[model samples]
Target: MSDATSLLTVLVTSPRLPAGLMSRDAWTALEAAERVLASDLEDPLPAAIEVSGITVTALPYDSPAEAARALVDATRSGSVLWVGSPDADPGLTDALAEELTRLDEPPQIEVLVGSWDLPGARLLDAVAVMDALRSPGGCPWDAEQTHESLAKYLLEEAHETVEAIETGDTEHVAEELGDVLLQVLFHARIAADEDPGFDIDDVAGALVEKLIRRHPHVFGDGDASTPDEVERSWEQIKATEKADRDEDDLLAGIPVSLSPLLIAEKVLTRAARRDIQLTYDDKADLGTRLLALVAEARAAGTSADAALRAVLRQIARPATD
Candidate 1:
């Protein structure tokens, strides 16, 4: 077909986009390829009318079928049939997908974009962007960040995510979650860049696998109704997982990095798990013990927590004297 005939056909075949809603880039690219058609479209396009500068022929179809018919009418042979971003409407996208599956000569070079899994997909994108910015043409800050240098940031972002949740701010939580995602993506990018084996996909897949593996009660046949049942199931799964790795003792999993107070609480929790009489009495007796501790701390001219910590420390490392 001649270039003019082919160009007209291309416009006819192109999807009838919403009037005045098309992106500037899309219009510009169309005009660059076929200026006459773009100009015709630009004149009447209600929403994107200002894009008359875009110089594209606009299809006057109230319906998509009419738009598709225009495509058939305008074209005789090979031409570019620019479909707008296919992933725009869920229903329309499904119909288009079904139509594509039925097409005899489906448009080659047609690209797909976007997905339901946006957050995960964005992480993948971020890893790629991070790598790009750290490579030869990459940003200096990103290029200079080692795993160690970024550790504090990763930890901070995670804490921010927790704080957002604690504050019950949905918007802040969303943004903070993104910050956490950034750190995760950055680390994955660094890993892939340094080792060539680890990437954002691997990081995500590992987390997905771990969650599914751990939640056998949810994902598998085992059903748990209560929180206690859920916890029991989780511990059972955890024990099985640890046993597979030849690690025993649930308490042994606690990190040494835990602060002394936190470690004490955790240790006491584990001890309480044994049903031992560490607390010497009931709720009343427990309050009495706590009051006694407060009195002892007061006698030492210090706060209860501080006084306990001081006594624990002295006993922990008794001086040679």
Candidate 2:
């Protein structure tokens, strides 16, 4: 077999494109091929290529080995085997390689990437999925959910994400983070249905704006050399952003929706940062003792909320078992 007869070119491409969306190089390869082959005849891509005046032959072989054998035979005549979207069909390439290596004159394989997925494109897919779930004639549970109803899930997912990170399991962390992202998408979708509503784009836009506004050192001329300086800048920026709200008390913005332990810790931490000394009565009850313990935990650089959660988990495990 001569060098011209020993060649096989596999064109890998995304199946999501229309006829004109394909690259010029991909069109050229398809037009120039002596024999174009695809695993699935029913796929729109083969018919689309045929519309451009290229004959695409769907391989009649049932197995990968059989297809490989046919490809080897076709390439023996020095014909170009234009494999359509081989990336979509796994194990086919390996089978072709196995059959090709067995022959004394193997075809030189070429893998062509005709198209690529854009960065963060999957996020659009997630938003679409959420919108579909909440649309009319969609999931009843999802359609009925409101921001108020989904509040618990948002809190739960955030805690689960933190727990996953603490476990140091990358897979679990990714799964939990995806769950958190779903909550964001779900809320945005719900909001989109309301009067004067906003979608995921609005949510993303607001977030981008907030990040840029807070990160003056990176995005602006502000110079924050240390982590502490950056944090101080962030707090100052946040305070200015919230200045329009009528919040006279320093702890007025602290969320009452948080758990008692968390609220206690946050209040104590804020007081400490502001140099506000809190005094507890010695004759006070268990509640005062617990508050004092939270202050002590803060002073020792430990999370009172986390400490309580650990104890609660220990107590709950036995009952769950």
Candidate 3:
């Protein structure tokens, strides 16, 4: 599993201020939480919090965070973190000045059971986590990828993001979007490696500028009502901004590599713009034509799509046919 899912960030906000105090129950919860957390106990603590049922580890060791690390581990194991007045003596607070060195996982993380959830995301910072993937000292496969080679993956990730939204899975959509973002970051990293000027920030800034420049309706004085009008305005602005390019015809925009069905659809769509109509309002006519096509395809040993393509091809290039 990816670290994102496994990593948690639990924040136990106390109703009271952070006066180095916690309720007994909260301390107990923290101890329970520690069992599940993975700890990197490298440091000492500024204080030694002592509770009847729960124990805040001793202080004044090598690192300052030793006590917190123990608590983190304990909290992960289901220890409850206390936010209110702590039962432990105030002396522990100053003594528990343990260094909060980062941990990928905690053997135990003490969190208040009913208190704010201690999310796992903050255990490791972004740079520290992604360092292994994007570093010169990281994975060779990841380091070798380039913008062009990763384009298809970016597209696929975007498609998955769209699917996730359409299906109304916000969390899944978030995850998929993250995948897309990773691809983007990966590409940007490659671009930076290839040309020192193009980093992730540059890419983001360029897009932001493009959006503002194109959206005179939203960001400027141009008037556009509905989404369709906004889209029309956007297209016009984009066209105005874009430089002239070589084109044999308006139809040249459609790539030849599209499947025949899609190509036929596109060609016919363009024809419709020129005032051609292909309509079948009658339900009986629709059913009869569909059945006829299926039967004809069976007889010809071809799919309905293929047969439809053949017909569209004749109509599309009538003079050549």
Clashing pairs in 2: 5-78
Q: Count the backbone clashes (under 3 Å) in each candidate.
A: 18, 1, 85
Cα lDDT for residue 185, model 3? Answer: 66
Q: Residue by residue across 1-321, what tens digits does model 1's lDDT show?
A: 233434321222212333544445544445554323321333334224334554334544444454444454344444444333222322433444454456554433233221134243444456666778878877889878878999889878876786577557899999998888778777777787674468777877888998998777778888888876776677667777777553324346776764444445554444434444353333566656664455444446555555555577679878895
State the C-alpha lDDT per candidate.
0.54, 0.78, 0.50
Compared with the true structure, what per-residue lDDT tens digits does model 3 show for residues 1-321?
Answer: 112222222323432233234455644445553322211122111132332333433323243245444444444434333332222323333333332234444333222333332363332233244546878788988877777778789878876786677557899997998788677667766766663557766887899999898788789998888876776676566556654732224354576755544455544444434445444333567555664445445446555655565576569868653
For model 3, the stretches where C-alpha displacement exceeds 4 angstroms are 1-132, 246-321
Tell me the TM-score of each prediction against the true structure: 0.50, 0.72, 0.45
Runs off by more than 4 Å, candidate 1: 1-82, 85-121, 244-251, 259-277, 280-321
Worst 10 residues of 1 by lDDT: 8-17
lDDT tens digits, residue span 1-321, model 2? 646546777877764444346678877777777788877666777777777678888776677778777877777666665556534666678998888778776777787766656677578678778878998888999999999999999999999997777657899999999999999999999889889899899999999999999999999999998986887788778879998755345566778777787788877755655678889886899999889988888888887888777787678775553
Best model per TM-score: 2
**Winner on TM-score (1 vs 2):** 2
Model 3 per-residue lDDT at 252: 44
Candidate 2 CA-lDDT value? 0.78
TM-score of candidate 1 on Cα atoms, chains taken together: 0.50
